[model samples]
Target: MNISTIGIIGAGNLGTKIGLQAAISGYQVNMYDVNDKILARSLKSMEKLLVHLTRTQQLTGDEGKQSLERIFFTEYLNLALQDVDLISESVIEDLEIKTKVWQEIGEIAPAHTIFTTNTSYLLPSQFAEISGRPEKFCAFHFHDVFYSKVVDIMPHPGTSSEVITILEKLGRKLKQVPILVKKEHSGYIFNTLLIAWIDAAGRLVTGEIAEVEAIDKSWMINFGMTAGPFGILDNVGLDTAWHITSTKRNPASRAFAALLKSYLDQGKLGVKSGEGFYTYPKPSYKDPDFLK
Candidate 1:
């Protein structure tokens, strides 16, 4: 369909990052969100990020300006998607919400337009059921903070090779390392490995086998310290991690569920709220509560 205009249905962190990158790559980008405030906030954040990239010489001033100019943010779903060649849905993680959004996109988007989701847990086959045009839909997963780079391209049984070709090409244009996988597994490759690791850590934390810092230190120091489990948990947000783990209702995940519930009950929501597993004091440090 000679894809050019890209439409993103969510304007959160991942959406903002990917939309900005696509726009910077010279593709027309349209972002849609139900909340006007969220859309505005995302736009402001994107501007700030582009300015930083320009100042650091990662992007030329002219390039940054062009990128910012290329992106258009709106609250109307139909308008944002009208002429889009590709639609990427990054809406709430709930399956019901995704199903409705995909169904609407299928009805509104151009017939040739391809639809993709950034869901981490739900299988593409399940999402495809809602898209109606399953042959033209797939899962285009992106890593948080990594933008278009390091994406997992998963196609459902119904998705055609042509759609995958276009998506992979677009991913490359956006500087993403796109890997095509055949199965419709939940969590795909990264999260599958990550969830297993996290489950193990959860077991230790709940059992009080070691203090939080001790456990964190052992892994960070032993595994090169790029990102400790606590740091990741914090970054992912205690509430988010809790929900992800709670979906399966496993005994190993119960501790995290309880911990997050307790924290939320106390109104501590991590870095956004200036606290979580750690305290945010200029240079934040782990909170003792995590250890206890």
Candidate 2:
């Protein structure tokens, strides 16, 4: 299918990035959220991102303006789905919430519109039947679109070959390297590796093995990495890490989830909330002397 118009279901962080990238790629985008405030925030985020992209010379001033013009924000689901060639759901990672959102989209979205989920760890098969179009459904997971350019194309047993082909082409058009996950593995590839690394960091903190900064410095100095697990978790949103970590039954994961929950309760959701493992806009890791 020639995807021209894309509907983004969820105007949160990742969803907003996806919609903006689609618009920049010359695809008309409809970004949807249940709350008006969230929709408004998403637009502001896009505007800020455009400024950065323009200043960095990644996009021309006129191109950034055109990209914003191509995006339409709406709170109404049906309106967003109207005439859209594809729907990418980036709703909360909860199965129940995602299932409910997919069910609604399945009912209202055009029959020809392809359904894709931006779920991080969840499998596409979990919602395929609920969407009422198993063959047309797949997981089109993305990392940080601008920085981390890989897009994972994961399809369930029922997904069609044609859908996979279309997504591969679409991923490239969006300027993302496409990776195929042959089976339904939770957390896909990078994330699976990330979880283990994060679990270790969390253990060090929760177990009082080391301070957050020490752990981060250890990884950064040795690996030449800019950020460590805790720093990365901050960018991922402490609440999101809690959600994913809470699902694990292991003792270490449970303890880590509890630590994350404490941060969430304090309203520290990482970069978006202005604080997490460290304060942002000028996080400690960014300090020139951090490693020293």
Candidate 3:
């Protein structure tokens, strides 16, 4: 499985992050979104990522620009899928929409093209049939490609061993530490741990056990972590968080979901919208003494 060319469906935060990361890894990336506006935003976000990477010396100025040069943004799905060896989708987490997209990809993409979803909660098996090649479908869940370096890959039962081997290599090529899970699990590895931790943080706030700032501060000071759960929420995007919380059954979780929805309604979608649980580009969490 030679996968030098990658197609990323969905130009949202995760999609854009994946593309920029792919570019940095020297792969030709095709970023596709149905909405042109979303595609434009993704392109701008890629430029900003390149600027940051260059500023941090992760990439040279020329390297950053060249990385950007390799990304091809398109509203036309067919063009983006052209000759793509692997397609990773980072669309909304809804099962229905994802299945539909996979069905479409099954029809449009080449027969040998491998299909992977960047879904955190849903399992690949749920939509493997629609993918046209269950043997080639798997979950390649990435955790904030910029900061977190891990990508957990869970292949469905029907997925081929060859696909798993190729994806592991691809993950390394993208400069990620890939963890292979033999069985399909909802949320795989880090996120399985993360969802519980975040839920507890949200419950604490809802129960008035601590204020949002206080909760994050406590975690940062106690653990020497760079960012706490609220800070994590900002990075995860309020919309995405809200969608994840929608799966909860308890009252506290519902309250947290509603709170996230309120923020979403106001367009304060964290890093993507520039305001979420905290402000972005210069959130207070970035301060050296924020933990204090």
Root mean square deviation (Cα) for candidate 3 = 3.1
Q: After superposition, how far is residue 156 of candidate 1 from its true place, in Å?
A: 1.3
Worst lDDT 10-window in candidate 2 = 235-244
Identify the superior model by lDDT, candidate 1 or candidate 3: 3
Best candidate, lDDT: 2
Q: How high is each candidate's TM-score?
A: 0.90, 0.88, 0.83
- CA lDDT, every model vs. true structure: 0.82, 0.94, 0.89
Report how far residue 9 has shifted in candidate 2, in Å.
Answer: 1.5
Task: Enumerate residue pairs that collide in model 1.
Answer: none
Per-residue lDDT tens digits for candidate 3, residues 21-130, read 99889899999999889999998888898788889988899988888899999999999999999999999988889989999899999888999999978899998997
Kindly list the per-residue Cα lDDT of model 2 for residues 84-181, writing each as its tens digit. Answer: 99999999888999999999999999999999999987899999999999999999999989989999999999999999999999999999999999
What global local distance difference test value does model 2 have?
A: 0.94
Residue 140 in candidate 3, Cα distance off native in Å: 0.9
Please give the TM-score that candidate 2 achieves against the real structure: 0.88
